[model samples]
Target chain A: MRHGRRRGRLTRVSSTKDKLLDATVETLRTHGIAGVSARTIAATAGVNQALVFYHFGSVDQLLAAACATATAQRVEVFHERFAEVGSLRELLAVGRELHTVERGTGHVAVLAQLLAGAQSDPRLGEATAAALDMWARELETVLDHVLRRTPLAGIADVAGLARAAAAAFIGIELYEGADPQGAGSALDALDQLGAILEAFDDLGPVASRALRAKVRQVTSK
Target chain B: MRHGRRRGRLTRVSSTKDKLLDATVETLRTHGIAGVSARTIAATAGVNQALVFYHFGSVDQLLAAACATATAQRVEVFHERFAEVGSLRELLAVGRELHTVERGTGHVAVLAQLLAGAQSDPRLGEATAAALDMWARELETVLDHVLRRTPLAGIADVAGLARAAAAAFIGIELYEGADPQGAGSALDALDQLGAILEAFDDLGPVASRALRAKVRQVTSK
Candidate 1:
C-alpha cells in the first residue's frame, strides 16, 4: 500500500500556480512592482483574474512566492557548485561566469528589485531573508577555504568576510539596475582585480604568503 | 506691477501637494508600495482623495515626483561636501557619517524602493536617472583629485574609477536596505582599505612613487 501509486490531488494549483509564478517573475522584470496586479498578472498567465485571489489570496503573496521560488532554485544550483570550491581564485571566477548569464536572463535585476520591494512588504521581507540566508550559507563554504590561504586569516572574521562578499555581489547587481551604461567601467575594474588575483594564484604558496604579508603591512598602517 | 507680490491661488494643491508628497514618503516607509493608494495617501495627508489626481495626474507620477524631490535635496547637500574632498580618505569619512543619519531617517530604503519602482514607470525612471547623474558628477570631482595622489594615478582611469566608486556607494546602500546588521562588516573592509590609503597619504612623493613601483611588480606579474 505504501508503494502503490495514487491519483494526483485536484486541490493543488500545481499547473495553474506554476504558470502564475512564472508570469510573476516575467512581469516583475518588465513592469516592476507597481505594474503588477491581479488583472495584469492573470492576463500574462492567460488565466482568469478571479483565480488570482482564489489561488494565492493576494498579489503580494504571489509575487513573494515567485521571488522565493526563483531564488531557491538558483541557490540550490550554485550551492552544488560552491561545495567543490578550492580557492578564492576559483570562487571569483565562478562569480564572473554567473554574472554573465544572470544578467542576460534578468535574474540579477529580479533579485535586486525584489530586495528593494522586500523593505515595503512583510511577506516579501520574509522571502528575501530566506534567499539571503541561502546565499550566506553558500558563500560561507567558499570563504572558509579562501581565508585559509591568505595571511589575514588569523585576524579576519571568516563569517564576516563571507557576508561582505555576498553583500558586494548584491550591491553590484542593484547598482547595475539603475545604470546600465555605467556597468562596463564597473565590470572592468572588477575584471582587472580578478586578473590581479589570478596572477597571485600563479605564484607559488611562498609568494602568496609574501604578498599577503604586504597586504598585512598596508592594512596595519 | 510685475514686481508686486501676487495673491496665492486658494485652490492650488501646492501646499496640499507638499503635504501629499510628505504623506507618500511616510506611507512608503511604513506600508511599502501595496499600502500606498489615493485613499490612503489622502487620509494620511488629511486632504481629499480626488486632489491626488488633480495635482499629479496619477499616483505613479506623484510617487516619482516625491522621489525626485527627496533625491535632489540629498544630492545638493552631498555635492557641497564633495567639492571639498582632496583625497579618498575624506570621501569615505563623509560617506560613513551620512550613512548613519540616512539609515535612521529611512532615506536610504526610501530611495532604494523608489529606484526599484522606477523600473516599472517611465516618469520615475527619468527622475532616478537625473538623480544618479548628479551624484556621478559630484563623485567625479572627488575621484579626479584623489587619483592624483597615488601610484594608480598613472595607471588607473580616473573617469572609470569615479564611476566604479559611485556604483559601489549605490550598491552598498541598496544592500543595506535589505540587511542592516550586515553593513558594518562590508563597511569595515572599506575602512581597512581607507587606513591603507591613509598610509599612502602619509608617505611623501618619493615613497608614493616607490609604493606604486611595488604595486606595478605585483600586478604586472
Candidate 2:
C-alpha cells in the first residue's frame, strides 16, 4: 500500500490529504457543491488531477473525506468546550463560544454546502447525518450526567429536550451567518442563548423535579 | 403595467413569469443553487431564450422574484394563523401549523437552495434576510399578544426571542427536509414545537412575570 511507501514520508502523505481537504473547503466556500468539480479541487490543491484520484479515489470520495474532516473537527471542538458544563446555564455560555466560531470562521459555510449537497447525494447525507448523531449523543451524555446529579421532574425527557436544544442552536447559527448585519452583534447570539437558558431555568418545580429523576435513572443505569 | 390585463389574458402574460419562477424552484430543488442557471431555468420553463430577460429583467432579478414568491405565501399563511391564537400556547400551535406545512411540502428543497445561495450572493442574501426578519416580527407580535397579560420580563427582547424561536423552527425544517428520509410526519414536527413551547411554559412564573410586564409596557406605549 502507498501507506507503506510513505512510511518516512508521513508528512507528505498527511499534507497531501490536508491540502486536498483545504482545497475542498475553499471550493465549497466559494462555489458551493455544484461549483465543486474535480478539476477545480485539483487546481486549488495545486496537485495534478491524477494525484487527487490517487489520494482520495474519486471526486465524490474526496468531497466526503473533506466534509468528514470538517465535521470531526467541529464535533471535537463542541465536546472539548461543552463537555465540562455541569448545568444548563453553563451550557449557554458554551453556546456563545460555538456560535462565534461557527459564524465568524467560515465553518458553517462549508457545512452548508455539504448539507445542501447531502440532499442529492446519499453518501454525503449519511456521512453528515452520522456526524450529527455523534454530536447529539455526546451532548446527551453531558445532559444525562448533569440531570443525574440534580434530578428534575422532567429529567426523563432530557434526551429529547437536549436534541431540541442542539437543533435550535444550529438553527440560530445558520440564520446568524445567513444575515450577519440583521442578526445583529455577536453579543446578540449570546443573548439569545442566555434567553433560552433563562427560560429553562424558569421551568416549574414539578417539571424540573421530573427531569432530574428521569435523567438520573437513564444515566445511572 | 400589465395589471390591467384581464384574468384570462393575465394568465397568458403571467404564465411566462410563473413558468420562470417554477423552473427556478425546480432547478434549485434538484441541483441546489450552484446548478441554477438562466439557461437551465429557461429550458425548464419551456420559454424562449429571451423571455427570461423580458419577464424578470435579469437573472438576479429572476432569482429574487422566485424566492419572494416562494416565501411570501408562507408569510401570508403565518399572518393569518397568528390572528386566531389568543395565548402563548395557542400562538405556538399556530407556529406548529406553519412548520408542518413548510416541512411537509417540497418547499424546503427550494428553501435550502435559497439559503445556500444566500451565503455567496449578496442580493439573495439581503432578500433572504428580509424574509426571515418579516417572519420574526410576525412571531413577536404573536408572542406579545399572547403574553399580553403575563409578567415576562423582555418585551423589548420579544423580537429577538421570536427570531431565535423562528430560527430554530426553520433550522429543523430545512435540515429535516434535506435529510434522506425527507420531511417527517406532521405530528413529528408539531411534537418538536410542542416540546419547545412546553419548555417555555415550565419557565412559568419567571416567564409569565417578565412577559406580562413587557406586554404592559408595549401596550401602554
Candidate 3:
C-alpha cells in the first residue's frame, strides 16, 4: 500500500511540473514575455502560486526550465527528419515545413518573446542562446554530412553556415509577422539559392573542378 | 517684441521635444523596452515627466517618433556610402562597417529590444517594421543597381533579397550578443556568398549564359 501511494504521489508531482511548463509557453504565446509572472503562470497552470516557487525556486528559473523543455521537445520531434536530409535544398525544404508547423503551434511567438526578454536579462539570454544552440547543433550535423563531398566543404565554414541558416529562419519567422509577403519572397529567394547549390552538385567532374577553382580563387582574395 | 518672445517660446518647446526624443533612445539603450516609461525617459532627459505627455501624447507615441527619427538620421548618414557601392561585395563591406558602428553605439541593442517588443505590441510592431523598411529601401536601391547586369537580376527577387539581407544583419546583431564568435562566422559566411556572387558577375558571357541556364533549369522544378 505504501509503495503504491508513493508512486501515485510522484506521478502527480511530475504532472504538475508538466502543467507549469505548458503554462509558461501558453503565457508567452498569449501575453508575451512582459506578462510572465509567478501569479500569472500559476493562474495559467491552474495551480497555487506558491507551487511555482516550491517547484522551480523562482520565476526566472521556471522560465529557463520552460525554455529548455519546450525547445527540447520541438527539436526531438524534428531529429529524425533532420537525420534524413540528403542535400542543402532538402534541408531548406525541411526548414520551410518546420517554420509552418512552429508558427501554427505558436512556438514561434514564444521564441520571439524569449529572445526579446533575453536582450536585457543575462540569465534569460543564456537560456535563449542555449535553446538556439540546440537547433544550430542539429543543422551543423546535417551540413557536415551533406556538404562533405561538395566544393563548399573546402571553402565554407560549415558551423557558421549552420548558424546563419538558423538565424535566417529565426529572422524570417519574426519578419513574417509584419510582412508576410516579403517573408515568403525571402524564403523563395533562399530556395532559389538552394536550387543553384543543387545544380552545382550536379555539375560534371570537369565543370565541378573549374567551379571549385574559381570559388577558391575568389575567396582567397 | 511680442513676435520675438513668441519665437523664443517656440524654440524652447521644439528643443524640449528633441530632448525627449534623445532621452527615449537613451532609455532604450540602457533599460530595454520593458524599462521604458515616461518616468524613465523624462529622468534620462532631466526634464519634467509631464513633458512626455505634453510633447508626444503618450509613451508609445514618443517611442514611435523616436524610432522614426533615429532611423532616418542613421539612414541619411549612410546614404552617400550606399550610393557609392559598385558591387555586392562592396555592399557587404559597407554592411560590416555599419555593423561595427551600430554595435558600438548600442543601437543594435535598442533595435533588438524594439523588435522583441514588436512581437507583442502591434503599435510597436508597425513602428519597428517601418524603421526596418527605411534600411531595406536603401538596400533595395543598391541591390537593383549592383545586380542589374548580373545573372541574379533575372533569377533573384531584389526586394526580397533586400529584406533578407536586413533580416540577416538583424539576426546576427542579436545573435552576437549571445555568441560573438558564432556571429563572426555568420558574417564571414555572408562575405563568402558575396564573393561568389561577385565572381559570377566576372564570368565570361558564355559561362554566365550556361550558369543562368542551369539555375533556371534547377529552379523551375
TM-score of every prediction relative to native: 0.77, 0.79, 0.89
What tens-digit string does per-residue lDDT give for candidate 3 at B1-221? 12123344644344777888878989887777767899999999999999999989999889888888888878888899999998888999999999999887766567666776677778877888888888889999999999888877766667778888877777777777767787888888787777656656655666667777776775566
Which regions of candidate 2 deviate over 4 angstroms? Answer: A1-9, A149-156, A184-221, B1-9, B153-156, B178-221
lDDT-sorted candidate list, best first: 3, 1, 2
Candidate 1 structure quality by residue, lDDT tens digits, B1-221: 11122254354344777788878887777666646788888999999999999999999889888887777667676677777777776888787877776776666567666677766666776766666666667777777777785656665544555656555565566556566666566676666555444444444565555555554653454
Instruction: Name the regions of candidate 1 deviating beyond 4 angstroms.
Output: A1-14, A48-58, A80-93, A193-221, B1-14, B83-87, B196-221
The digit string of per-residue lDDT tens for model 2 on A108-196 reads: 66776677677667777776666556666777777676656442423345555555555555566556657765454323533544444
True contacts kept of each: 0.39, 0.30, 0.44
In candidate 3, stretches whose alpha carbon ends up further than 4 angstroms from where it belongs are A1-14, A204-221, B1-14, B204-207, B217-221
Considering every candidate listed, which one attains the maximal TM-score?
3
Candidate number with greatest lDDT: 3
Model 2, docking class: acceptable
Give the TM-score (vs. native) of candidate 2: 0.79
